[model samples]
Target: MMAISVTQHAHLLASRALGWLHTHRERGALPPGCTAELAEPDTVYKPLGETGLAASLVLREAVAGSTELRLARELLDFGWKQLGGGSMLHERLLRYPMMSDPLETYAHYARCGYRHEPLELLLRHTTSLHSTRAAEVLPNRRLAVANAARISGFDRGEDGDEGPRTGSTGGTDWAGLTAATWLGALPEPWLIDWLTAYSMTHTVFHITDWGRLPERLPDDIVRHVGRWLPVWIDIWAEIGEWDLVAELLIVDNCLPEPLGDAAVWERLAGIQHEDGLMPRDGHPVTGDDQERFAAHHHSTVVAAVAGTLAVSRTLGTR
Candidate 1:
């Protein structure tokens, strides 16, 4: 069979996602964020938390950039409601600086029974694990190392020292690197570095937790996992490595850009079913037999298709 070019494959994927979105809009099943009421609240107002708001922002910014005038109006109105309502939902939204002003957000979150100290503690514990140091050294820190160690099956050693011994296994070192990268993106970057590192290490090692981690897993960690992992294959491909394509695909569509390489586009084109659904590999890691893995028939497929198309289109523009 002749090889399909990257541009052509991307167009096909974009067409598929656009068609699906159109059908969904027509059926009134489109996300609430895309609705006409996104700006105006009626009796059907649903309060999206910070993460949901962020997702809406990404979608609006990326796919709906042309509809900014409409989205902006809704977003402003939504912001007003969140600020005025004084509800717990709105309060949680305030905890996120990206959602609103930090001081005001924290005040609301505090009023709504949210504690800031715990977040601090979580970060400290995470940092200790990443550094392979004792949490006691940072006496004020709320250590969650025991919890993390439990998840990874590591032992809590004497005198509050837990996890792999010094240079015992390089896995923790890689995990620490991932964690540090993640923590470095936080508001109090140094304090939260540990929590960020812990979450990244956990996600990479515990593949099943890929999409299950809370969105607040340190901004840097989220950004790295969200952005870098998907394009990892592209980095490898640029150096003439095609073998990583399948592994990359497992996490590709999770990001905003799914089409990282010509091979990825080709694989997507081959695997798409006649019913317009992409199958998923039952296992998170499909060892060796990449072709045997199934396309995910869920919303992930729709997002992946759209992202692939968008990346393809952007590449064409360049």
Candidate 2:
């Protein structure tokens, strides 16, 4: 299919995914794996903390842009109510000390225009994580904290070092973060597992603002990711891991010079179901409605976001 057709197909899938999510909600059906036996409060936190699936679905709504404004608003409303007025992150942090997923998820809501005291306070809390949390956290988490800080207008000083001066006197520890992450010293791109590869993609996208702020990334790091991305994309696509494949597509668009592989785009478009339910992998979901939605939700959402981001970037450039 042509580029415009590809864009249209993505929107169609996004619409279907949103419709499916809402239809399930109207029936009082919890997402798959969400247990109804949990007590009142557990009901909210359980789904929130489970496997990152719900949060991914919530983000897909934000990424849908103006096309799903009404649905997006409804989803965000449900999210706030479910998370106990959005203090779940704060509560989780008080308990877990140095978790990274909460920070990332909180940042997603913040990015979606849901700014409030809870999120703002968490962004401030990230400052402490730089020292106490940085050593133990992965490279992707470090980038995540920085991105959250930037988005929330929380500066980590001009040096970008929350701790003492560890790197060169003036600049942020760009070099240090790269050295810490998988992408910085890209191993055999074909050999890394899917999750690790996806994490690398996240690191690159967040650190470089999805390639819009390419200068923030080191020249060698940028070249390194761009060089091996096609191989990684092809391998994952052939395996029919649509979630990771869609993520790789986002990564492709985020490269300074995007790969923009028409054939790969075609493959992704071909796999999307008529109702926009992109299977998480080669295997199909085999369960009840809620179970099936839970299994397939993350990949379907990823496909929507990947398509939206690619189309938006394409439109911006044109």
TM-score of each: 0.31, 0.77
lDDT of 2 by residue, 158-245 (tens): 4443433222123345567667888777567667886798788888777765544656677777687788878888788788788898
What is residue 247's positional error in candidate 1, in angstroms?
9.1
For candidate 1, the TM-score is: 0.31
Model 2, residue 205: C-alpha shift (Å): 2.5
Clashes of each: 14, 0
Predicted candidate 1 versus true structure: per-residue lDDT over 100-216, tens digit per residue = 122222222332233345432332333234343432322111123222332233423432235444434323332343334333333343232323433433343222222222332
Question: Which residue pairs clash in candidate 2?
Answer: none
Ten contiguous residues minimizing lDDT sum, candidate 1? 137-146
CA-lDDT, candidates in order:
0.35, 0.61
